[model samples]
Target: MTVLSSSSSRFPYAKGSDGTRRLGYGADYNPEQWPREVWEEDVRLMREAGVNIVSLAIFSWARLQPTAETWEFGWLDDVMDLLHAGGIGVDLATATASPPPWLTAAHPEILPVTASGATVWPGARQHWRPTSPVFRDHALRLVRKLASRYADHPALVAWHVNNELGCHNVYDYSDDAARAFRVWLRRRYEHLDALNHAWATAFWSQRYSDWEQILPPRLAASHPNPTQQLDFKRFSSDALKNHLRAERDILRELTPHTPVTTNFMVMGGTKGMDYADWADEVDFVANDHYVVHGPRDEGARDRDELSFSANLTGALARRRPWFLMEHSTSAVNWQPVNLPKKFGELARDSLLHVAHGADAVCFFQWRQSAAGAEKYHSAMVPHAGADSDVFRSVVELGRTLEALAPLAGSEREPARVAVLFDWDSWWAAEHDSHPTARLDYHTEALAWYAALLRLGVRADVVPAHGTELDGYDLVIAPVLHMVPQTLAKRLTRYVETGGHLVTTYFSGIVDEHDHVWLGGHPGALRELLGIRIEEFGPLADEDTVGVDAGPAGELTGDLWSDRVDVTAPDVEVLARYRTGTYAARPAVTRRAAGRGTAAYVSTRLGVDGLAALLPELLAPAGVTSELPECARGAVEPVVRRDADHRYLFLVNRTDTPVDVPGVEGEVLAGPAVRADGRLSLPPRAVAVLRGPNR
Candidate 1:
């Protein structure tokens, strides 16, 4: 990921062969995996599937340069020309995603070292360490060669910097990383004394007299210092960003006209990279998102999580169109139980990304592998070939994207309500020695999203840091634990300037250094929220706390609860603990500040609980669903706008048919509109409606 700065002159989008700009629809084309005869068939199938672009040579390092002294460009040259002739553009990769066996055998030290001192060998991809100068030198050499070779190719539409970086090798405990960490620390904090103060070394008898003493938070006898762990996380992400800068610089210098971008893994447990910080480095933000399976949830919940990820990615791109680099056409091989996508799930999922502001929708691969670790993974052409249902859906999705060519470069319309996701807080809040180990920061945020979906409220999930708070009327910051003085002041100013705020438990507890705000619990926000918490009353796994919201029904809360006391004169206690250790205490409170108001929830309210409480909190601000009452919860609404009209995407998040009344617009995709101006969508289907921009 690159730094989080706005790029005003980003490449608008990739144009089609007919000299018209259109939404990119394709997959990662790995022609190196098949015979030369297969290449001709691949291009034929690609055309039949309506694929305009293919990201080529992502992991062809070994075959591209077989040995140190050898260069094999004939096969790649033919493929590039063939794709160009077939009217398919190529997002050419530098082919440096993985180190060649010869290079690794010569310089094994470039391999990453785990916290436990185990070397990560070269059997898998992304084996090289980010801080290894040896690895960087070799990678940059390859990048320069690829860029110089493809600089004049007509098929080269964009430069794929490298495959998903830091996916497998984010955390490295080698000597290279240690030296880089010190350099990053010096750049961040010029003096050792400043570093000592920020890390609070006095507590652990770990005060550093010199810069060399500091190391990554590697495996140790007991729990490492909290601040050390947090800094290491920051440093690791920066290390990867520096490498991306290195690759991007070479590509820019060689092919000054080509736009360079690297894929970011923004889904599930991949928290090592700060994507918002890396947004500005590329020409266009590209993200690789796969629906995480397992205990998280399934079906509609899974789609909600996907929508959450796409929403955050759109925010990272500053609401401009972004590239959906990689997703599945059917099942992914990685998850424990690989579940194949149902009938309409494939097209439904892709359109959801487009609705959230993706201008390009691509899958993991073009063809299913004959032999590889991902043979079971689905592709545009499945193992059963193009005659299968998966490929049929691929063709249908391509037609849909073509019909959506009119909305290609449209920006994502701003939602009145926004959810702020903080990477720093996510890193610090989950560190060891917290009040409760069961506290999951993202789960709490996703719960809020699920609640918002149930209420049919459209909200953009934006990065918490450096966000334009004035753009949104209501902002929800969940588990905002690492609040620095700057953020505190910014949030205060936002509320004072008539911005409605809703924050949950465990927020505003610490500063940027992971140091507790000394006064009391929920530190920095205590004054603004007009409430004080003495201590955290975390419940056992099976225990539950009954909260009474007066007129609303009683709801159950688990995992965490706080003992709150009102400090402001006009603060209102919206809910009370009906049954708990501190029975009848304030469980939720709100206070008027300036023209707006701030509210706090002290318990871990699941999706249903929060949904039950949102209406009252939102009424005063006049923030209600724009959708009609009959279609509210059953359909998820997302809007995109251009100079003329706004496109409304109505996604059915249910298994049964849903009728959305009062939907008046021309249908560009999916079923036709009813005579009564109602939208009757099939299960797992998406309908795009174009209406006059309001």
Candidate 2:
């Protein structure tokens, strides 16, 4: 057996007697949904599946707290004892993710209300208003009770704060929300005059004379104030964070030794919670990701969403190994068309996360649900029971995880390039009023990332606000719409100190409050990139213009075009629009400042355009593919290094088998090696190879 050592000293869990940290494998175990007779069977199957950890009591608030005064622990005690006796640890949840129907019935004001004055009824989950004092008090009481009861339990390993906070009711425009929003505004702006200035409330006679009159960004005749809407989003995320902190405090006070975390929905379209802000509150990070199916082509749908999500989650964990808190065993029920994983896809998807930096591989559930909104959702033990192929795959995956136990604490190797992902920018960029309604933040960021993956280059997806830029050789901020002054200075200093930067159109247009920065477009970065945008020319869906790069050839860009003017003599036009009203303007400009270089893109270059342009953009920074010559562009290689070993994860996202030659190493996991020195990865397969650090 190979011994794997961690690069980070902040490993949260203890090591086994063999000096290797076993990779945790389990699912969201809700034994309360089953009979007491079924609980022991669940434990038996868990041990058989090498399930060492299970997240318990995630949505059991109704069962745990039957009424306002009644508290029941007999069933919970039995389940916890059974799990512990079966040698499985528990990520004990506070069960505050959903309040009981009785509680909501007793306190009707706790229900979340939409901007249209529609109350989110109790038929669905996560219907409680985050800002309601009634809800908070009841939630905290239950959390205190759970903590006090289970603080010394042997099964407890970590405290699961709340199930995917703000998943549904992130924003509540009720009177309670209005009150909390006012209090939040008062704390943020200090006075009504400052609030007026920040929100630019002078427009349309909307100037606020009193804080009490201010309301949540509810329905208006026209569009609401953009700044007010932005602040309301901020307050909504903060409100959920406050709830988490309220529960986290109780858990920490009672169980100081146990770590606390909540599952973050870090997929493409999830925008409710700003996870970067939430990451600091957790002891370790965990994320739930499912395949994003859309009107997109099949290949595009399967194009490594899991890897992208896990990489972002790992970056949120500060490059430490984070937990794969929840994913489906096969197809998910929520998408327009739910599709099952093809052969070998389950292991492929699971290992892809491990390749990024997942220490655990868990799922949404242990057993298939017989009823509920997610009855058809896939699970470890599927609807077909223990004899099913899903169960076999689950058992096989558990064995594979045990084989890869030495990789539990390993971290991904530091990358020379990083892609900036900011929630503030996401919120601000996608506002009702923007240059282009078609502008998607994650799509643009993923375009850059997918290009890098195609070139077999590993890149960190970091938040633009709080991340340190000194470590990276090249930084790319795609559609960074909201740029605070501090971040602007940091980027300036980073470029001044010789780090390369690439920012796209609609970037740096506003400050933290969605207030447009004066001077010119691409606000604070105009001086660094040596370009001033006079106006934005948004293209229609059918409209596209050609940008002629000298050697990279003509690239077609759409959605947005900025009329750029070169401010300095040293600013070189790398690409220019070949047609359209802004034909002669620079589509892409590069400038050398002090010892660094900055490139400004004036349009949204789709994936193909970026694939053509990135090589030229990254060449000056001396960033190259880490994969072998034969594997470059064919197999996706992610390198993670420790003191003794270099783990290379090669994932074949294509439909055909890829032969990656000139690779010499011991196959740690995945497909078997060919007769030659090449690694043969089948379609949707993954290869984890370990070798000495070269």
- The candidate that wins on TM-score is 1
Candidate 2 accuracy as TM-score: 0.96
Clashes of 1: 4
**Model 1: which ten-residue window has the lowest total lDDT?**
1-10
Candidate 2, run of 10 with poorest lDDT: 1-10
lDDT of 2 by residue, 1-694 (tens): 0111123323355355356678889999988778779888898998888898999999999999898889889999988998999989899989988889899889999999999999889988998999888988888999989999998998888899889998899989999999989999889989899889888888889998888889998889998999999999999999999988988988889888888888999997899799888888888888898876666552453455666788888788877778889998998998878989877778878888888888888998999999889989999998899998989989999998888776677778868899998898888899886667888888889888888877788788777766778889999999888888888898999998999999999998998777888988889778888989988999999999999987889999899999999999999899999998799779999999988999998888777788889998998799988777666556777777767788888888776788887777888788777778877888877888889977
Question: Candidates' lDDT values, in order?
Answer: 0.89, 0.85
For model 2, the superposed segments whose C-alpha errors exceed 4 Å read 1-14, 17-19, 296-298, 672-676
User: Residue 73 of model 1: what lDDT?
Assistant: 89
lDDT of 1 by residue, 548-634 (tens): 997657988999999998999989999999999979999988899998899999899888899899987887678899888877778
Looking at candidate 2, what is the lDDT of residue 272? Answer: 77
Residue 511 displacement (Å), model 2: 1.6
